[model samples]
Target: MPQSYVKRILNARIYDLAVETPLEDMPLISDRTKNNVIIKREDLQPVFSFKVRGAYNCLLQLTDEQRKGGVIAASAGNHAQGLALSAKHLGVNATIVMPRTTPMIKVEAVKRRGAKVVLHGDTYDEASEHAHSLVEEKGMTYIPPYDHPDVIAGQGTVAMELLRQHSGPIDAVFIPVGGGGLCAGMAAYIKYVRPEVKVYAVEPEDAACLKLAMDRKRRAVLPQVGIFADGVAVAQIGKETYRVLKDTIDGVITCSADEMCAAIKDIFEDTRSIAEPAGALSLAGLKKYVAENGVEGQTLVTINSGANTNFDRLRYISEQTEIGEQREAIFAVTIPEEPGSYKKFCSLLGKRSITEFNYRYADNRDAHIFVGMQILPGGNDRQEIVEKLQKHGYDVVDMTDNDIAKLHIRHMVGGHAPQVENEIVYRFEFPERPGALLQFLTKLAGRWNISMFHYRNHGSAYGRVLVGMQVPSKERKQLEALLSELNYGYSDETDNPAYQYFLS
Candidate 1:
């Protein structure tokens, strides 16, 4: 029988470690969306993540024998930090098995909390298997990140705070889903107490275990997952969490890497708090929701899940924010490769600030001008610029929506591979992480001969992978079908002029 989690959630002892973070109103986002945008500042928690609530509560409920043996966990990052802090608080020994490629900042954080930090394999799969081995060998109690009942109940405390703090009408609460713990917990409690207040789950499109599970109506395992948003990059939703989530969660909102960057930028501008990629997911979902649907004046809330981002990762986030927010528009312009062609194109731009311009003449007849122009904030001028350029006899292709242009070509202008035969070029968006390239190869490598491959790390929620595969004209549809089944955002660049002139 399933226990009443609402009752258990209210009874959980977490305040000893967790803080009742303030609910802040986002003025800029509210004005932009024509709605009341509020954020739950969980990033301000002691461990800089909401994981502390679950960790402390779970540890407190453990049997005396289990506590004596200490605890062990396999975490991508944030859970380990939470457990470490919880263990320190309880004066118990804790051992954390973390992914080897986890950012140095997170690894250092676990160590600072006095936990035995074990850097295992590169992915969560590898780290998980290793953690189980440690539990057996060291006689430690294995603490499941989101699967256990105690952990779920502990996380539900967030809803308790939310309902108690705010008396106004809440249209929805956006939560970031990793293993579904937070979503499951909050959704269960909120739906029980206030069914009208929808609990929306936010996830990275590349690593959306809960979304896939919901679509299938069963728990599904992801062979490959993106790690750009490291904190919530779980391969599969937890059993207990999934069981609760399948019934209670109102909707799932998926966000792209670029959109997440935009959300992070929004948070930084408003609060000067640098939330991690996963931390900024809820706002990304909120913005995505506002853009896609015609909803306004409703109050929405999203949690700043954590602030454990790496220092160097800021470069990736900062670069993509302009495009993500539509503050800058990029385009590929085709012009006559004559002496005055550049001047005429500049005139068509009409005194707009040029963020980037890369002009390379492939031949004497035509030249490809890669350019970026600053767009007015909160204004829709992308299509207007395209129409204005077309009116002036300039052929322009809006590259703002093109992943290859935004990720690779804009940064590195001419790297044309020479003389490839029967090659079909396709640009794919894969989860950005350590083994993503290898995972792509593992899926479709042996069947086709990869003629040319170019990958650019955009530091967004996803990695940009451009692969050129040699396939006969007769078998082109077969390749298309395979790619369609893969369900990744991809485009055929085989007939692109840039490829014809420079690479192919």
Candidate 2:
């Protein structure tokens, strides 16, 4: 049976370490959706996340002996800082085992809070495992990021503030879910007090553990999770949070990394504050909910859960925002190899603004043109543009949502591998470490020649590389063996359309 969670929230000893964050009305999103949209600005917390509340609440329950023993925990980013700050406030030592996938800025922030930082494996689960091992070795208290009663109650304080801040009718409350502590606490309180108000839990599509749990009627573990929204990229929902979610939350929604990036842009445009991907997750889900359910003029509220964004990530986020919002589209068009063909193709687009155009001339009868166009509101749909080009006797392929087109192809428009045979293009992501690239190259052992290589560091947790290896058919099995031994996350992209069209 559920305890009196609202009472527990009211009594959670956390006010000394956490502030009552504001509930700001979002005029831009509200005006766009024609609804009263408000954001619970938990991002304004001293720790830049609502996590401090739960972290402090959990630590407050520690015995004097336990506090003296210190605490151990694992986190991707936000929870680490929250717990670190809480431990500092209570004069307790904190050891945070964090995933290497966490951004450098976040790692530095956690250390700045006076926590002993342990950079472990690539995922939160791996970090958690290391933390648990420390618990047994050091006899320190293990502070879970979520799944505990105290933590849940502490997170419930968010809903308490929400209900008190706005007594008016609210159609729904959208919350971002990772381990689900925030959703569990808030949903339980909201359901107990204002039963009419619906609660929605939002997650990234690449890591929708709550949605999977709801569908299966039990806790579900994801085989893999997206790293973009690292704040909420949990492989499995916490058992305690799943229990509360099943009983109290009305629905679960999922959005893509691109959509979250778009939400980040939306928040920045309105509030002049940049939110991390997980912080903007609730707003992304809200947009999807409105578009799918045809919701209009209803009061919807979502929490800006955290603002612990890495400044360098803003470039990639900005690049993806327009595509996420459907305000920009890209295409590859085929036209005749004649002098007037370019002029004719331009005429077909009418007055639509062309954002990009890339063409590499080859001695062929037909030529391909990679084009990017601005998509105005209330303008012609992408398909309409394609159809118009088709009517003009030009073949077109839409590449707006093609990740290869977005990530690599557009950057290097065309580079034909003339005589390179058996060229296998592979994309790999490896942990950023000194001599990492050299180590990978050494592991290959000169079995194959590298025909092409491309790498750009935009300050991500991992280094991304696009490599074209000239491996013969007879050596394919050998190459696979080497890759398995080297053990880097990779994908074979030899047959990718972007590769075939732009770089073949």
Candidate 3:
């Protein structure tokens, strides 16, 4: 036996996948990396993900009779869609078992591809177990999501594309690991073709099964997986993928929900395409690795493997971006419960925009009044800001340093102020672009006088604004009710404590 039969099978699997999928050199992202950073755009493949490569390769190795019986697969989302679509194209019946918690959008996508969709348990592992049982009961081919050699070899096609697309030797390749099929396959191929190149496997912190497995020198299982990055929320690394990957990978890393969100935002801004959180894991890992290890001057490649995402997930991503990047600060200010107190507090604010204002008359306390403000991001002097407020006899609670603000208030926020009889509080979700604020003000015109206004522009698609306008009592009802017609929301906050503090 010159070479083992298993080794030959792995080689053949990789060969088959390379012929079917196209590779693209992502140039815009390359310039930023400064090391001829190329992307294996597995996201652009036939199923809009690299999963098809592995699923199809695995199917091709299946016997014709088994193919006729059809295939069953369990996926967080993408793999189900991939296997179902590929199986349909190959004229094989596909039954996809997905978690009940799986987004309707992904379920519809699988159904649209002509696959039988079965909503099973609450998590992928449960759905996968159900599919495995079906394999024995129905004599259908059970397509392992990431553990089989065929699947790994199919995933290796991304490495082949990168090697062909880029001119120089790759210093490192970053791959996102859910069950580690993609990373294992990519690492195996890279090791075989270019052994010197570093292979990095990235996983979400909540689902770092592969990294934990590597550290323990064995497959590690997580009690529960994180659903934030639903695409890679594997509670256990696949056994076969682990065997292929254990020694080939250089290191394993973890990323937070925020880091993933920031990476998704970066990739979107760079390419105008939204990547699923798992797809952005490679980039997130690269950034974390580079910053931590101080690694530089090496050509890097990250596999942007999938783009299927729930549009609603973008809201969570946007909410986490600022905290992950440390670009926004939230604070609570205690001003005097007296006349001209609001004016003094405003004067203390130097070149800062208010993103939030939560003030309530907790008690008839004269010494303190609670107010929350989200300061503009970057280069903030927390001490100076606090000192200035204190100089004006206002106590400052830097909620930026408070856990409550970090966890709750930062995300569940809208501009809030006290309600006034003649004043109306309107919430405007304007585009987060320069001059957008001015356009909103211009739209208001001379009909309403600005009593109080608050706006802060985070790097979000839309900015939230709370404007307090003093309108005649006759016009107040009409003004408050007219915003809905203009596509904005108005709440009569005249009775709100925060509003009364600033208004009266």
Comparing 1 and 3 on TM-score, the stronger one: 1
Q: Higher TM-score: candidate 2 or 3?
A: 2
Q: Could you give candidate 3's per-residue lDDT for residues 135-185 as a string of tens digits?
A: 999989999888887877777766666666765777888999988888877
lDDT of 1 by residue, 130-244 (tens): 9999888999999888888889888888888988888889998999999988888899899998889988899999899999999999999987777678778888999888889
Q: How close is candidate 1 to the true structure, as a TM-score?
A: 0.85
Q: Give Cα-based local distance difference scores for all models.
A: 0.84, 0.87, 0.69
By TM-score, rank the candidates, best first.
2, 1, 3
Clashing pairs in 2: none
TM-score of each: 0.85, 0.96, 0.72
Residue-level error in angstroms, candidate 1, position 277: 1.1
Off by over 4 Å in 1: 1-3, 376-380, 416-504
**Local error of candidate 3 at 269, Å?**
1.3
